[model samples]
Target: MQRFLPLIIVLVLVGVFLRMMTLEGRNPNEIKSVLIGKPVPEFTLPGLLEEEADLTNAYFNREEPVLVNFFASWCVPCRAEHENLMKLAQEHGVTIVGVAYKDRHADALEFLDELGNPFSRTALDRNGRLAIDFGVTGVPETFVVDADGIITYRHWGPVVGDGLEKAILPALEEAR
Candidate 1:
């Protein structure tokens, strides 16, 4: 029985090692949102550029797919993907709703001034409450919502490089 105990311990250790190996090389940026297949949370946020206006799901017309992107002035990845966002807004004429999460109004304004804003409507999430409702972990996360107001897909990290062609474009089509 003592000799068999040593063999069993060795087998257990080998199994544990193999299981850990399976986790390696996995993409850490991929986060499947619990909100997928669900309706976007309803909230009213102050406009990023204007104080008199408010942004709410009520304004979302159930006739076109839209991109809801959470970004911050301080997030480097957000800056990197700004151009692609512009392409979506101008080239494809896609509607993009931007959320400036946890950034000062002045800073967000400055960032947009430097990068050229591409948002159809920009909301200011000063306390990040809206981002919390959306289950956002960090800045530069994007969600594709169908015309029915259902969230179809979520993309973590910056959507640039081949991500625009391979993942983002396809998801937008699916949402439509």
Candidate 2:
């Protein structure tokens, strides 16, 4: 029995590790952010629209929580999430700030025109500097920022189906 004790402990450790990997709401592809519970990184990006002012970290200084979405005109998942974004802004009156990551202004404009512009302010991250600061790994990533400019939640993929109700709405309420 003493000789078998080591093998039993090893098996228990392996089982625990595997259980963690398969935990609910844990996605193998998700890249966890280091910025959660921290203030948003300071950034200044040109507005996607020529007539609009530049978007800066100061835009997040508000009395309400804001959704910061990283998207691209070329990303198909971004299109899929557009409807939820619009619903959040229009129906729920959630303020959203869009960062167009590594996309041309014209293409972004066309994409918004085709779907509908949900962003109260849209900025261009043409060089991906802002996205990098935000620790964005891909298109359609979103961060929920509280009134104090701290990141409360991060959604790694397109906000579709249950993502809006289950995750985003709850995060927003918590931020409030």
Which prediction has the highest lDDT against the true structure? Answer: 2
TM-score of predicted structure 2: 0.91
**Candidate 2 residue-wise lDDT, 1-176, digit = tens:** 99999999999999999998999978988989999999989988999988889999998888999999999999999999999999999999999999999999999999999999999999999999999999999999999999999999999999999999999999999999
Model 1 misplaced stretches (Cα beyond 4 Å) = 1-29
TM-score of 1: 0.86
Q: Report the C-alpha displacement of residue 72, candidate 1, in angstroms.
A: 0.8
lDDT, residue 3, candidate 1: 78
In the range 8-67, model 1's lDDT, one tens digit per residue, is 999999998778667875554566699998888999999998643899987665698899
Give the candidate number with the greatest TM-score.
2
RMSD of each: 2.9, 2.0
lDDT of each: 0.90, 0.94
Superposed by TM-score, candidate 1 places the C-alpha of residue 165 at a distance from the truth, in angstroms, of: 0.4
Candidate 1 lDDT score at position 125: 97
